[model samples]
Target chain A: MDMATMNKLMECATFANCYPRDVVFRQGDPATHFYSVLSGYVRLFRQNSEGREADIRVCGPGDSFADELIFGGDTYEYHAQAADKAMLARYDINRVRNAAQADDGMLARAIAGSLAGQLQETMDCIANDRLNTAVQRVALYLLEQAEGQESPASFRLAFQKSLLAGKLGLAPEALSRAFATLKGLGVHVHGRIIEIEDMDALRAL
Target chain B: MDMATMNKLMECATFANCYPRDVVFRQGDPATHFYSVLSGYVRLFRQNSEGREADIRVCGPGDSFADELIFGGDTYEYHAQAADKAMLARYDINRVRNAAQADDGMLARAIAGSLAGQLQETMDCIANDRLNTAVQRVALYLLEQAEGQESPASFRLAFQKSLLAGKLGLAPEALSRAFATLKGLGVHVHGRIIEIEDMDALRAL
Candidate 1:
């Protein structure tokens, strides 16, 4: 987004604080506003009728959630909750729509870009889940998380292992086994922090 | 899309014909145009590095493809091929962009809606692949295809069983097993045609 659009959006922004595990919104709730995380983490998920939950995407600092709800649907399709205590900026959908319609639709193009990028990522996720084995899926995910970091990089996982397993469509035991198998690829897991000793070998998986 | 917008798009459209099994565009090709199916069918698929192909979506008459490529990326992420002999209308990306920028961005909102709907469908597909069993996925797909039909609905499958299996992320044998199981739910399959004798019973699966 351009500075002018950001300024306009910020002018209509309302600040909210959420505690860890607080529900930000539930599936089927009215999609009245768009949210941007200022700190901490948030997870978006969907539950089936059988009560099985699938993690969709997790948002971190500077990331936005539920923006797709602004266009096609009247309600949110997934539930969102704070993974940790966080500050967020909420902008009314109407205000954002109006701003997008203004200034020759520069903001609209930006929104389109965001949605396209999201669609690409989701398609990639679907392909990964369909094409890769559990171990390969875990390796691909580590490579994804390690993006933009230097070789021999180390970073803390944004969510718990169970949540990651759900996101990757793997059972907890399968996830554990996958992590153990990654030891052969030079990946070390020390609690939440992961150190990648050989990024090229990991990617070759 | 409104009549005026449709007229604008049509004015910029060029007609093209394709034979069955002909590729319209390959993955990673320049996304220079958007396509609307004028007749017949087109299948969009992705081929992994291992030469395994996964069907992503199939577009029929009046349906559009590659709208997600209109923003964020300059290349198509999936390959488009004619599932049958087909006629298509193609619109130049630059012309469409110009038109969207004109007329107070009414066209922009329509494009946004299209992108949002595509995102929702893809996400639903991902969720279905992740959360549903092979049998459940086949049942759900039958329900989806039978939507808007009468209770004792019978419709011809749009594609072959093998294609359907690929689209549902199931192996051909698994799909056959799913079909056998669905027979218990009053679903009868004859070649490419499916007859759902009891809608509620099928849904109850």
Candidate 2:
């Protein structure tokens, strides 16, 4: 986004706070606003009728959530909860819509860019689930986290192992086995911190 | 879309025809154009290195394919191929971009509407996969097809049973079993025609 559009949105946005584990919204709730994270983690997930919850993604500092649905969705499509004490910028949905309608489509285009990114990520997850083995999926997830869009050599796991397993669509035992298999390829997991000893070997999987 | 906006897009659009079993675009091809279906059916699919394919969705007359990516994607995200003889309205991507920028964000917002729709559908698919059983999925798929946004009591299966199986992430035998199981509940499939003999009973599942 350009500095101008970002400035405009920030001008109208309001700051809000949440305690750890506070639900921002649930699936099917009326979508009133979208938010940007200022501190801590926010988790987006889907819950089954029997009360099983599987994570979709976790947004940390400087990340945004539920913004892509501004143009077409009437309600929140999934659940959002604070993973920790968090600060956020909440933008009214109608104001954003009006701004998009008022502009020469630059803001709308920027929002579309954000939607495209999420859409790509979701589709890639689907492809991974359908195409890769359990061990391969784990390796890919680690590599993805360690080397995010802004590449880094090592990265700390921001959430719990149970949530990580849910994001990977693996059972807790299956995730453990996957990690055990990756040990042969020099991937190391020390509590919440992860590092790849042999990036090439991990990629080969 | 307003009549004026529709007229503007159609004014610059071109028409093309395809025979049965034609490839419109492969996954990762430069997304040069977005299209509207004038006639026939198109299938969107993803293929793995082992030459296995899974379907995403099928588009028929009065529907559109690959339109949502016009604003933000660089390449066709999935493969689109003709399932039957088809007529199409093809809009050049560059021109669409130019028009979107020239407008008062209305065109861009319209395109965003399309993106929102696809995003909602993709998320719903993820939710269905995470929450529903195989039989329940098949049942829901049947109900969805029968009760599309435009509700109808009976609907024809547009593509091959194998492709339908791929779309549902079911084995061919699993699909057959689902159909057999459905038969006990008064749902019937004969050739390509499907009718729900007991809508209330099917919905109870």
Candidate 3:
């Protein structure tokens, strides 16, 4: 977490351009590298038997992905796609391995923190799916979005509505109904942007 | 891993004896340590609102559990319980952290390998749930059990049939039908021990 080690980690990963909607990696592909999103939104998802894409998670600016390969893994279990015009930094697996060898707590922390974050997010997704109703899921997700955006009352959704529904494990119709429920509870939505009237009430829901 | 490092790791972890059905840790308990199965079986599960328990995973000899806390999480997200009379080795998180601070490649590899193995197992679970048919789930799971037990043709089931069903995310009835399907494909089952007559056919399913 010191300044020199932080600078070194930043230097090790170089920015690369990505077209909007480009596929970074697809499910079942070989997982060869780890990626950090310097700018833009990235959607991570998997396909179901019905051929519907289930959005597992999304990474916006500063978030990392493809951590399963960091130690050593051959196949990618999820699909990662660019959600918008993006700048991403890719790190070679060997570089990371070598960095870990150099006795850097910051790098180790970064790797551990990245995996931990993904695990937490995944557990949260599964828990919310099990513990809350459709309305609560929507309310909780909205509050999370507000937190992620660093704006408690207003923020824009990074992905499409259908993708959001998939991320929440809800059918599109259920998502629409949840939106109606939010409206009944005084939360406002316009296209992909949501304006939360009372963050406390949303969290309580 | 070298013998010396393995010995050191084993030395740092404390050992304990446990009875069948003993609670290793509850769902909301603080996750200050990780456990390695020294002997017998351990079952990890999550309970639903209806008090129905869904088995998330099972660990037998040489298997480890509770790596989620390594990433900065506060509490365990699942319950870990002894599936049978067991011996377990518990490792303190702080000890491992201090070991990593010493920049030991062996220790780093140990931690990385452990984390990677958990991630691999998780991916397999998701893939089995996603890519396999109901019959295939049972077949694949049986095959894995066969490999783990070193007896594909005949091995005793360590836990009840219902518990296995929960781990596979199938209803007991569905798991019964799956067993029947395996039998139809020439797999033999008596109580818990299963014998596979055709590994290729099982894999093909």
Q: How well is each residue in A64-138 modelled by candidate 1, as lDDT tens digits?
A: 878887675788888889888889998898778777766566677777777777777787777778778999898
Question: Under CAPRI classification, how is model 3 graded?
Answer: acceptable
State residue B188's C-alpha deviation in candidate 3, in Å. Answer: 5.1
Poorest lDDT segment (10 consecutive residues) of candidate 1 chain B: B100-109
Native contacts recovered, each model: 0.52, 0.41, 0.18
Superposition-based RMSD of candidate 1 using all C-alpha atoms, in angstroms: 2.3
Question: Per-residue CA lDDT of candidate 2, range A1-205, in tens?
Answer: 7888888787669998999889999988999999989998888888876777766777889877788768767889789998889999999988998888777778888777676666666666666665677898888888777764322256788877776777777778999999888877776788878767767677776
Model 1, docking class = medium
Q: In candidate 1, which residue ranges exceed 4 Å CA deviation?
A: A98-103, A148-151, B148-151
TM-score of each: 0.92, 0.88, 0.81
**Candidate number of the best DockQ:** 1
Which clashing pairs does model 1 show? none
DockQ of 1: 0.62
Model 2 per-residue lDDT tens digits across residues B1-205 = 8987787788769998988889999998998998889998887778876667767766778777677677667898788888889898999888888888787777777777766666666666666666676788898888877774322257788777877776676778989999999889877788888877766676777
